[model samples]
Target: MSDQSVTDSRLDELAETFEFFDDWEDRYRYIIDLGKELTPLDDAEKVPEYKVEGCVSQVWLLVAEDAERPGALQFRGDSDAHIVKGLVAVLLTLFNGRTPQEILEFDARGALDRLDLAGHLSPSRSNGLFSMVRRIRALAAARGGQSEPTLH
Candidate 1:
């Protein structure tokens, strides 16, 4: 795929990084560290509109059209749970700075499977993760001039 999308390239990089870990514990620690690296969100941004619906934790994701990069999206996300915040960081790494079509076409399930996350995550965590994916896609749809997205 010579014309690779940014989302695919970033996901590949993450899978390579995840493979360096010999154990899940180490992977979890790495994820938490990634969360720590996320662009901080203000308390005021933690309002209902940004709140992810399916997560047990208080999860928020904010999406915006990036002024610095035309046709690219920017994101900020946070979660009360450490691991969930890490998941938010993962999502940001995949979707941030991508164009709307890139986000809409991203194979999230495939990416998670490649990272060995599909089976490792608890069902609740999986649902929460997918919820965040849906939120990102929905926002992307709107940004692309589609009507407000309905959860698929």
Candidate 2:
């Protein structure tokens, strides 16, 4: 299967698995396994300039743009934490190479709920995930000319 197919399928599988598992332990293990399935990110992509701020773990995200196609962004990310790495993997697959409108239209919060991930994570980890999502959205908005007014 293509990366995109696996990405969408993984989301569906997560929803089904979460529904079947009654215990958080099982769910956590399942999530870890999911992380294991992530494709290896290139080492060169994980530079300091790509590092995502506010994550407790060492997380990095890199974005590339295609100017002719406004709002096109490609992402690559990595993390030291296995689970966090998996989470970033999932996000990269979904958001990468997407147009700004597409990224903005995605229901990331709803996807989290469907995957049943939010309730399992600690407050800080959840915050980190939100921060990552917001960063991607901001990048898309800035490139697409849909950015909201800023106080600066």
Candidate 3:
């Protein structure tokens, strides 16, 4: 598979793994493993301006949409913590390039339920993840509605 295809496949696999794990420890290990699979962000994309604030670990995100593929955002991210980075990677694979309406409609909490991940996570980590998703959705809305102010 090409790099992007592999990433998409890996995310599908992760959803499967989350479904299979019986315990949080196993899930945690799997999340860390997912972290290991992430492609490191390019050095040029790691500028302080791209940093995602409010995350306990260092997190950076870059968003772009291919002109040929309208409404789909492409995301690249990195973090100092392996597991956190993995989580970001998962989010990128699932939501990148999607329309703002789709992003607004996406039930991240529901997806977590499908993954069986929420009950397994530390509350703080879960909160941070929510924050990340909100930020992405907000960005999508901003770009999608360039002429209007978006409501939170």
Top TM-score prediction, candidate number: 1
In candidate 2, which residue ranges exceed 4 Å CA deviation? 1-13, 65-72, 148-152
- TM-score (C-alpha, index-matched) for candidate 1: 0.91
* Structural similarity to truth (TM-score) of each candidate: 0.91, 0.72, 0.77
Best-to-worst TM-score order: 1, 3, 2
User: Candidate 1 has which clashing residue pairs, if any?
Assistant: none
lDDT tens digits, residue span 49-135, model 2: 777787888787766785544557887667889878777866775677677766777777877877766777988888788777887
lDDT of 1 at 66: 82
Summing lDDT over every window of 10 consecutive residues in candidate 2, give the lowest-scoring window.
143-152
Error of 1 at 1 (Å): 9.7
**Candidate 3 Cα misplacement greater than 4 A, ranges:** 1-14, 146-152
Better of 1 and 2 by TM-score: 1
Root-mean-square deviation per candidate: 2.1, 5.2, 5.0
Error of 2 at 65 (Å): 5.7
Report how far off residue 95 is in candidate 2 (Å): 2.5
